[model samples]
Target: MQKKCTLITAAAGLVLALGAPVVGSLPAMAATAPTSSVAAAATTPELGSGGHVFAHGIVTLTSAVYDQGRISVEGVITERVRDVQINAGHGYQAGKVGAGGRFSASVASDSPTFELRFGTKYNAYNFATVESVLWSAVAPGTPPETPGPRPTLTPLPVPADPNPAPEPQPQPEQDAKQPGMPNVLAVSGTDGGWTNDFETGAVESLFTAYDHARREATVTRPTDGTLHVQQSSDGVTFTDRATYTAGGGIGKFTDIDVTLPEGSSWLEYKMWVEDSSGRKSEAQKFFVQEFPARN
Candidate 1:
């Protein structure tokens, strides 16, 4: 069942994800975006030596450096992108998209991979983009260029759902799910948030869950890779939790049902995917805060 109770009910729950859909293997050079985009500009990621320059559409990555478990990257985007976020599981770094659409972000990670998310006002619903990247270390001696002159910061906008469509609705109770179960629910939250992570490429995953507690959280990318999971107590640190050995349904390998650990509140959990070979996807932070018992 989805976990939806909170000591205090949040203004509709906020679930954010940082990672791309799983891929069987990195592409040779660059390929097209996997998820078909409703917007003409959207593209699938192409991972390569170009400093993880996959989604070079609106926000583009140009350079990357890794030192002492820290991975740093630089890129440029249209001024529409207000800020850049680089999440590396254990730690994350944030930088603002400056004038001329230039920005840089760095983070510490046990691995040299991360999910890229940005904020901008020009897009509908304060539109943003998410990209998955595998970065390399900077060669000895040569210096990486920097975007001189500190960029100014702007507020990240989260569009208001003044009037959400009342079509597909969630169950009045939580949607409990067992590990490895397929999620066929067509639900979006009253105030759900989403991005194009690696799972279901280009496919928009709107929020969907009822009050307090849902166990079925799904990812659709990496249609063939075996799904493994990692758990975090503080949303920063994570550890090996479980793996899904069950295969997908007749033409679907995108089901990712999230199950909370015993004795744990959904609030204290953060999750990401790992392939059979140990390659991990970006971590998604979501919680269906349980509603307190009413008197």
Candidate 2:
């Protein structure tokens, strides 16, 4: 489902709502706070971010930054959107749109494949997914100059060169640790996979949907305030079944057998984080297919 482009990064494919392109380094931060370091990157990669307007101009993702495995995002959400949240893997956080029509939230991941969704309580929303964190590990420092607003470029014809130098190929992601490497180049995170799936996909992808019979899903995700695990029979409409806040950090929350309501074929889930006031950011939605019975 991802488009093909040599310069494409998951940040750029933010459904194009983002104004700029972003790429991250491999051999990223560990599960806990970024504890180790790696070699400096050949070129400092741009921080994953967004400041563009989309959704008929009602929603604006002010900023979304991904470094190592931690993802932090700030945005100017419309008042219609009562809640704002970010979720990757099982880790998710929620916040209400402030009086100024803006909200800020963050989440952590155990893998590189993470996605950020900003939306209202209703279906109106926008999404930014980090398909894969590419590039070398580096420390946070001065970011490259952000390009000006989208410019209108007129395509012009040019004479073709008979002999052009071979384009340099990008280096592969490093799987092992680097001795002198900094945690990773973060755009805004105060404290956060550059190897294997961590560099190639989101933490959510690292986890599969719950196996109804077993009542247990794969992988463990981080949690802060509270995590709401809701199910949908049709994958569109969803209802709350259980709430979890007892356990902290990354843990298996969906460890119950599904009741399997009538007409339930596909099992879909959406995670929402609730604040102290019970306010939840009805942000992103993901589903785990109910695998067919084994012979």
Candidate 3:
């Protein structure tokens, strides 16, 4: 009976020890729940960009420049953004974020609203974050002023000459009379949007012929030898699509059954002029976007 009592006492001590472990494990599990929650909260990332105002009145915004609020998970930075886009006023620019997530864009005005976007890869994948900031909130600058139209000139009347000089004999036939304002409206060509250096000679009066029914895009240019028409869907990389040799000043290329991609609304056209003497003019690019439908 004494041996049975001693055994019962020892079993009670063992039960107490095991019971303490169970109680202790309860607190540990509760602690683990909070620790997991805290770990999850710690991994949540924050994204922001830095803006700088230059003395020349330009406001520059850069992504990944200042990484005060950036976050990392398991030592892997989650907010190292790749592509960055900035839109301000009428201008929109896009580029990839460089090392340290840095990409910069110039704002058009002071206190402008900048809509910034950050992505995970270069010009692909979904955006990681979208952010906006008012220029006034960061650095104050001036908005551009709208200049008035230029003044028109009035020609002075020449005094009547009592004896008008005889007209000189007409020289050899000159080049065809250039149009005062050519019917060919320039979308873009030499002396258009690209630049003003007519080093080789300007390829003027670039026009387009778009057949809505047939979905055709025709481009024309004047003062051409062989006009090379290049097309670009993204406006970045242009590929030479067709070449037309011109016998006269006017060079025209018809549809020839070239169509844009499905649901593609924007197209860019560029022209390169090559003369008989092998002289080539500077290339010019033109952007074409669809107009909104009328109500």
Candidate 4:
């Protein structure tokens, strides 16, 4: 039997596994802006001689959450050809993540970090912020390269309903999950204030559960933006809960004293952001658990 537990609520409205449809009016577009110049963008890395090639081995890439976490990342393999610039020939290799849950990339460079990148502003929710994992070739005719722990900092304390017994509703269809990535829950205790080293890539914002006692959360962003916290009762319709602003080019803040809706013991919270350019980011959702309480 599944053990029923309430979501630990936090200030930034970070839920564990919940989602809400986007609503409200769109922001106004800029009036008259100057035309920006376009440069030949380097989408992939350039390859060169004396670089590391893929030996007879397999390099596996795993998702932080699940397989179908709605997250699409590219494994970038780059090598320095010239003294300063890395752009040259096929010095870089990039490949799409296969449906069979394989993140195999044949790197042609001697030194390459198999980094996962989701182009700029392409937000990733309910996934890992530090998406890149490094791999080193073992030897010829050896087993495929084993993946080490992806460099991921701790996530902030996520929020959920404080009340234990809220009325339940029909659950929605779950997000598609990768085959290798399975859904599991684990709880542990630790001491100290909440801390999370957030990573940047395809994920613009992230919410994680740290300590259940503190009931607080911290949000960090690379650019100036506005963070909005929202809550939901049925895990479908959500209303505005709070708003925060990060001025300057970057922002980092921690929120406290987050309260849930009256008469609702089971609530799921999510967060969304608007960058300085008024561009909205994808919402980050968390999990919500609603099950029968044991007598």
Sort order, lDDT high to low: 1, 2, 3, 4
Q: Which has the higher lDDT value, candidate number 1 or candidate number 3? A: 1
TM-score of each: 0.28, 0.25, 0.18, 0.16
What is residue 59's positional error in candidate 4, in angstroms? 10
Candidates 2 and 4, the one with greater lDDT: 2
Candidates in order have lDDT scores of 0.40, 0.35, 0.31, 0.27
How do the residues 138-204 of candidate 2 rate in per-residue lDDT, one tens digit apiece?
A: 1234254455899889999998998998999986455432333222110110000111122211222
Model 3, runs deviating above 4 Å: 1-78, 120-295
Candidate 1 worst ten-residue window by lDDT? 1-10
Candidate 1 residue-wise lDDT, 138-238, digit = tens: 53234433449988899899898999888986654334432343222232222235532222212223343222222234432123322222222222232
Error of 1 at 195 (Å): 75
Top model number, lDDT: 1
Question: Considering lDDT, which of the candidate structures 2 and 3 is the better prediction for this target?
Answer: 2
| Candidate 3 structure quality by residue, lDDT tens digits, 1-295 | 0000000001111122322321111110000111222123322111121223222211123211112222111111123444555554554466444553335544344332344434332223223332222322222222222359999999999999999999999763233323431122223233344332211112332343221111123432333322233332222222223333222222344334223321223345444444445554454544433222122
